[model samples]
Target chain A: MSGASTSTAVIDPYAPFSQGKTIQLSSASPFLPRYLASTLPPHTSPSHVYNTRLRGKLLILDNPLRESRSAQLKQERAAKREAEKQRRVQGVMGRREAKRLGVWELRKEDAKWALFLPIHHLWLGYIAELLQLPPPPSDDILHSTDPSKHRLPSVPGTQAKLVKADLHGSILSVKRAKNADLVGRGGIVVHETENTFKVVTAKDELKVLPKRNSVFTLRVPVYAVRPGTGEEDGGPMWEFELYGNQVCFRSSERASRKFKFKETIEL
Target chain B: MFIDLNVPFPEPIVYESQFTPSKKKQKQKPAGLTNAHASTSAMAVVPAHPLERLRVPDRKALRERVEMLIHLGYTIIAFTQSVQSKLDPAAPVNWFDGGEGTVFRDLDPRFNGGKRGVVQLRRLNVVLDEASEKGFGFNAQTTQLLAGYDILSLTPLTTSTFQSACLQHSLPSSSTIHLITAPLLPSPRLPYYMKHTLVRTALKNGARFEICYAGVFGDGARNWWANAREVVRAAAGGRRDGHEGVIFSGGAGRVEHLRAPGDVMNLGTTLGLPHETCHAAISRIPKSLIIRAETRRTYRAILSEPKLVFSAVPAGAAEDGGEQREDGKGVKGLMEILNEEEERSRKRVLEADDAGEGQEGDGEESEPSGRKRRKRRRKNR
Candidate 1:
């Protein structure tokens, strides 16, 4: 007993005084576990100490009570969460912007190529390029939107493949005359006849005034000037590569004998 | 957790008084012509812009124009043999901008029977094949063949009360559609939905597709493959057998799988000509096949090159095969000659009548009358 007392004194110098105080105090005196020291209030008085001690014991001693409290809190939180979810569901339920499905709704890609109107000309062409539509008429000579007259891009001897090369910055000149033979020379032949024929020349287009019914000739194909004017007066010109350097001729009856120079200037 | 029912709650409604009919005297009934005139006035307001108004061009006039356009080296409607329109007789069907318009009811002689309030519509369908002894005869040499050729269909929901009972009937697929705006050059500007719709119609109505297929590499090889399995797989037996041949043989196997380059090349060669000529024909394309050999090239080839596959008659010949011999005298039998002469005389008289009416009515206005002489024939039958 003496040895134990000496060890207790070495471990805790206040153990003997603490034991004596517990025996001397009534039921109101504080008695808390070591774990509750950090959680409890710092008041160290004898009065109300038992209430603090009871609270500490209640928190530590019973597992069922703690479980019931936690479960009740979880239930309340779950109810609140479900209410919010229901409100969100009603918010988006009646929406006008939502897509209305049909028996056959067109896909975005399919809708792009539906028609050829002025508004969709450029965009439609891009879509056509993406879809890769086939060229019309598989045999014989090829035609444009107009299907009657078959077009030979170049003379038969010169089997050159023509394509659209350049449009802007290309110089085009227009000429009106009584005779078809005039304003055409070299490989160029008078393909057609009308009151006017606009000679679409290369970058080196020249300006020449006809000398009193004297026939002047050019070395390029001349086309009748269409009404629509662009940056270049020739309208949209396609590049033609000759299969061979063959000269071709076209015959046309003169419509207007009298020729007055209009806008036959450089453009 | 709560699952929301999202049921809509009803609000309160207030009672309202009933509307009482007025006890005013009835107005006098208008004359038939006045009523017609009033309806015409209303219809005129419907399409204010002249260009936006649907013009029912005379079939003959349109055909002539198409022919002229074709001759001029422009690509017009190539697949169609003819086009006509069914519309309300009361509505002013103006095919042109000004007067002397080719109205549908006024032109077609049979339509004169009972057309009143029906708004006739212009519809265009094409004849892709003709019936032959060997079965349906298609343009074999033409590489760019238009598949899924079907009667253009339309459904009219409403019309004025003045239309005749026959006119109020459901829209007919025979002549309710038309090529209002034809394709430009090299290619036709048709929407993908339109193409899809056309394909669906064809598939549902015993039509086959002439697919422009290309094959690409699967194992990252340099060779390209053809993806014509859709065409072959969707076809009947795919062989040149009898009617039972329509059942595709490759359906049992995985047809969508990427085809070998050699097989595609062989199929292209087997299909008469290379795909380069026609929009739908198979053509060999040298493309990098490493990533996706089957998807590099554009697969939609709808347009076709025009060819002289059939004609009403040889350009210079009559009903008889007279052009075979180089002799100046006609080779036709006596009866054939007599018939030809009679036909020529009849044609001349008709031509004279046409010339006389040229000022009052353009040649296009008379085309609807021509349909009375011919009858529509079903191809499958």
Candidate 2:
């Protein structure tokens, strides 16, 4: 009995305080289990205090919990790195596909050509570029008018000028044509021959319109010098209705012909 | 400006008398040549028929139809042809050949004369039916070919197709996809798949929902009305969620199918759309669509500002050094000059008003007191 008591006392330092009592004072303490469990090594079994006491001393220097937490962090970082690589690869592939499908080319070309041009003038630039012709001269003089001067006719002899001037690059709108085909169409003059004028329509279709029997109203932006003022007069753009049947000469030949300007008298 | 975005090309008219013998007999009777013996004798006298009788009246009919739309105050009309397959890309496209003495010549006789409002032509919607996977499969080549068209629309058969299209197109990145909302026959209500959430996503992607009103004029008026009501409900939801991507258009095939801007607006109101939104659906929304289409087709065309061309200055102005000042000038000069001129005019008007007030004070001193007394009486009452 004395040897057994001595061994118990050596193994447990608090054995002398808890003799034969069923309810010991140390068992009721809140800090005992929590502190022991926290002090125990992560790899050791947590349920039995006897096993922990046996193995806890050997594992005291080794922090298995900290090692496990670090390993888990490394695994998470690798997954994140993999996801980032995948995203980058996807981005590159998308760009390549866009280029292959001409989407990139379209966007780039559009940006390069349309960067400096205005929207309303897009048609003019488009037709000019397509037909390999210079765009129509800007209407600086006509648009430079004060509100009061806007009501006055900017170009007094527009009808006469239209009949005599070169009709290249002029915007033509069909007013009245004996042929039903030339009634409501409008386009920019691409090429003018003796009998027919090639025009690029708004839809970008090239059409050869015969210059016979069609009544065309041309919107020619003209700069008119004010009489006696010696200053450039800013006026509204001029629209003149001319009978195509009257002018049968080529655009180049029209400049030399002294044709009578017969303006359509609107009833 | 009102825009009728979908008008199918009219079929060539075939004269009934040319096909049926019964109609020929009726025509002969009307001409007082019912007697078979007399008719035979007349036919022998003039073996060659008159040129007028041989002429086709289809051109006249088409012209009249376009004119009727113009008279009804539609400033723009898009003649849409639905694209069915890859083999027929140009099938739905109709190039108005008015300039080349084709059938469309008389369609807008006064268009260029500056006598009426401008009637701009556009190819509105190119419908892609993604119902048949084999026939209407999304082909990259076809999409590229359709780039020539202004607006491209997709009509998905199933909800999954709609979602897939939205996912693939990335509607927010490109404003190319136009959602067509036509009446669903037999079942007028919105399909279960067309959920509010899906519509919200589409709206977020910059996809516009189109409401074609031509279906209202035909036998499917009831169905169309029901469909339109559901669309309005969806639009209302979108509006509440701070999105406005709805557009109203006339998908008119014939002249009788066309409606005035006011009438269409009234129809929109009946469909539960707000007054302002209804007006915008026809005018502002369609205008933006046209601009988007134009930009899509023309690479060199930008929609930022109006393009200006520099006309040769007058010799006199050139000498005055005004031309030099505007040599490298852009939109800035034009806008600044106009604004300065407007400010000067406004100041002059104010000065005139001050002078007029002085004159009025001298002319009528008693009238001013009477006016003040009347004002005091109104205020007291």
Best by TM-score: 2
Error of 1 at A257 (Å): 72
Among all windows of ten consecutive residues in candidate 2 chain A, which has the lowest summed lDDT? A111-120
lDDT of 1 at B108: 22
TM-score of 1: 0.15
Which tens-of-lDDT digit does each residue in B105-219 have in candidate 2?
2343222332443343434243334434344433454654445344556555455555654545424222345545433443666444566777777666555677888788768
Candidate 1, residue A161: how far the Cα is off, in Å: 61
Interface RMSD of every candidate? 23.6, 17.4
User: Each candidate's DockQ score against the native complex?
Assistant: 0.00, 0.02
List the global CA lDDT of all models.
Answer: 0.25, 0.50
User: Who wins the lDDT comparison?
Assistant: 2
User: How much is A28 displaced in model 2, in angstroms?
Assistant: 66
In model 2, the Cα lDDT at residue A172 comes to 65
Give the CAPRI rating of model 2. incorrect
Model 1: how far is B325 from its true place, Å? Answer: 22
CA displacement after TM-score superposition, residue A106 of candidate 2 (Å): 38
